[model samples]
Target: MDIIRTISKGTDLGGKDPDHIVELCNEVVQEGHSVLIFCSSRKGCESTARHISKFLKKFSVNPQNDDNEFSSIISALDALRRSPAGLDPILEETLPSGVAYHHAGLTVEEREVVETCYRKGLVRVLTATSTLAAGVNLPARRVIFRQPRIGRDFIDGTRYKQMAGRAGRTGIDSKGESILICRPEEIKRIVGLLNESCPPLNSCLSEDKNGMTHAILEVVAGGIVQTANDIHRYVRCTLLNSTKPFQDVVKSAQDSLRWLCHRKFLEWNEDTKLYSTSPLGRAAFGSSLSPDESLVILLQFFITLIIFEATAFNLVEILLLL
Candidate 1:
């Protein structure tokens, strides 16, 4: 990754300059190289892709310009048209120029088309959110960071390495290059991060993160843990248990189970002294909803039902108001 050359558009700028990013991408594409731009959010990806496409439109900078019929582009368009998402308006405008955005916000069909075209080297300039860093194997000759962040917070060494690693792939390119756009004041921090090793991995099931509740819910819903002893046994094998005292782990597990039961996600049998997932619990697990989220959904559902029964308003009207 290249970090020595810091381009300054003006003094006192807080973030990346779009003009510089566009110019840099244009130069890379004009040189017959594919580039990937990492954006912080889905909206950022879309906007950056559009900006690059517009800037490159003035000149014949597209690497794929030699294809008169744009056969690959046409095939991609056909696939999107036939899929449920149809042809996205932004994609319809940008894909012809070998540019597109990839993010979770796009439908499965849309993401498939973008991934297929980009992998085949049809789409030269691709913009995507940080999720793309680890989700797919589509590498590029050059990778550019619109900003040195995944969101408001600066990226850590591990994330930086993951995104930068995509710049060059074995048997794909002669060399790989990555560029991170940051303010002049951030150069030192960025350099330190580049030189530093990744931090040690840690468990996210702590009380503050609230992952334990979800974890306990999954096991119970899946019938993996049926009784209190089973719950304790499962907890004993967790990383959380290794880090915390056994009694503490047991207490947390009990709290999670109490919360789940109170939420109608679990039922206890006094006769057999066993625990089982309730219908609501199974529904929550199947939908992958967290405990708090499921509670909110359940409340909303009941409120909607009450509104439907107490008034003459149609379901659509009640939904719109809610």
Candidate 2:
């Protein structure tokens, strides 16, 4: 794995810089390999894909109409039009030029269309959000970080490494280049990050309060660990015990149990000397909602029952909120 920084003069880029990106992508794809371009936002990804498709149109007069190897991509796009996402006309035209974009704003089927098109080489250039870097296993010959930021915040070294890891296509490419596209001024910081060693790992259970609370609730609710001692024993048999101190894990588990009890998510079984989940708490375990989040939602449900009459608007609004 190699990390290289590409410093470009005209990179003070606004939305119009997709043209420059498409040119770079063209050079990479010409080598008979795919290019994955990472954009900071969904809008940026769409813009880049448009520029790529437009640029490719200049070189090939009838790229889309040709009997392309990946015929599935055309059918996939047609299927996407039926999806509730209401396919963009630009996207409809761009995929045929062997270029597309993927982002959360696109529905699951729409994103699937882009992924399928790219994987099958129907789409040579794909511009996508950080979701492509982290969520998907799709790799390309060249992975371009158009910017060092994902969304509002600038990415850190750890995230940048994960993105870079997607550069090399395994089995096909012997070596991978992790290219960081940044301004000339930012070169030193980028290089410094590359040179530095990664930091030691820490358990999120000890750090993320919301996650810890939810996990603890699951344990009691699922009957995984009934008591504080059971919680400690469970933690001891896990990988976290290797890095974290034993007593600390037990203490944290105890604290979490107490918090859950206070939240009314867990009931103390005095006779059994154990903790169990209440109905409201068990409901949280079965949901995507965190323990704290579910508690707020549950309390609100009770409050609404007491405070308001089941009027049409109120009922609709409450259901919508859920």
Candidate 3:
């Protein structure tokens, strides 16, 4: 039995009361539940974590040390427990119980530590950037969105939907709760965005002109295609989906494939409707083999040109030349 509570028409508390957020945080902790507080910036994460730590001190936790070298979430928590110093200008205090900050810039190992702490119930609250909504599965009993409105037009609906989605966890809590603190006028849009169903954005191939050109050149360099029909068959069978009829997409794929064929990276057969990679193409693909590698050797061969150009010219110049 999950309940979705919408707090409509409320005062904007963006910078108003640190105590209100801290109090709600303490309430969640007292019930032995974890909470997630989403903030806009890295500095905001540090600031919110600090403010909550002050109110948390009564629960017997010390503040974090400014000089302490904290590389991971576990280390940060440990440092907070060991140090007895006051809060930093940005960070208020350590979680009187347990809490941590999560963001992208931190190393993968550090993010793992934060995730581990939340799952183990060692960290009662996590103040993090919106990135947590996508890749990680760390769920909280309560999710507090500190940002009610994003400025960008394209982000309005999609961004709010993602932040609101974090409210519910399937296994841990029977139900989940999300709180959005905002001015009264903004509530309807927030609620509407949360309730509406929007299709996921379609994935598009990179439009980097130079990268596309290089990809074509690599195919040519490998000596693959001998005829225009071979090039057309390759594009039709491998690159462009037969089901979808987007002329632009088909044209792009055809052009790029033709360039590869002309460069000799692949040899094309009209009758068999097959394009085979050449000797140079095979060696290039296997030159730096790894089980986890993403692109095939031919694609990598094409990418090298873009990389080389990037090194030689500034991005603006490269774009202009491309």
Error of 1 at 143 (Å): 2.2
Candidate 3: C-alpha RMSD after superposition: 12.1
* True-structure RMSD, every candidate: 8.3, 7.9, 12.1
Candidate achieving the largest TM-score = 2
Per-residue lDDT for 1-322 in model 1, tens only?
A: 4546655676222135444877677667676778999988888999888777775633234535556438768988999999997889889888887899999889988988999888776688899988888778989889998888997889888898889899878887888998888888998899898898877766677898898889988998888899888988898889988888989988998999998889789999999988888998988899999988988999999999998777855766889999
By the lDDT metric, which is better: model 2 or model 3? 2
lDDT values, one for every candidate: 0.83, 0.75, 0.60
- Candidate 1 backbone clash number: 0
For candidate 1, the 10 contiguous residues with the lowest summed lDDT are 10-19
Model 2, residue pairs in steric clash: none
Per-residue CA lDDT of model 3 for 1-322, tens digit only, reads 2455433335333235632787667766676677899887777887787767655523213235312322343465564334544222232235333667888755655565557767766677888887787688888888887776432232366666677666666666788787766665776776676677777543333344234434443444445544555445544553334434556555776666665557664567779666666665454445633211323554776799889887777867878988
List residue ranges in candidate 2 displaced over 4 A.
Answer: 1-20, 57-70, 169-173, 207-239, 245-287, 309-322
Full candidate order by TM-score, most accurate first: 2, 1, 3
What are the models' TM-scores? 0.59, 0.68, 0.51
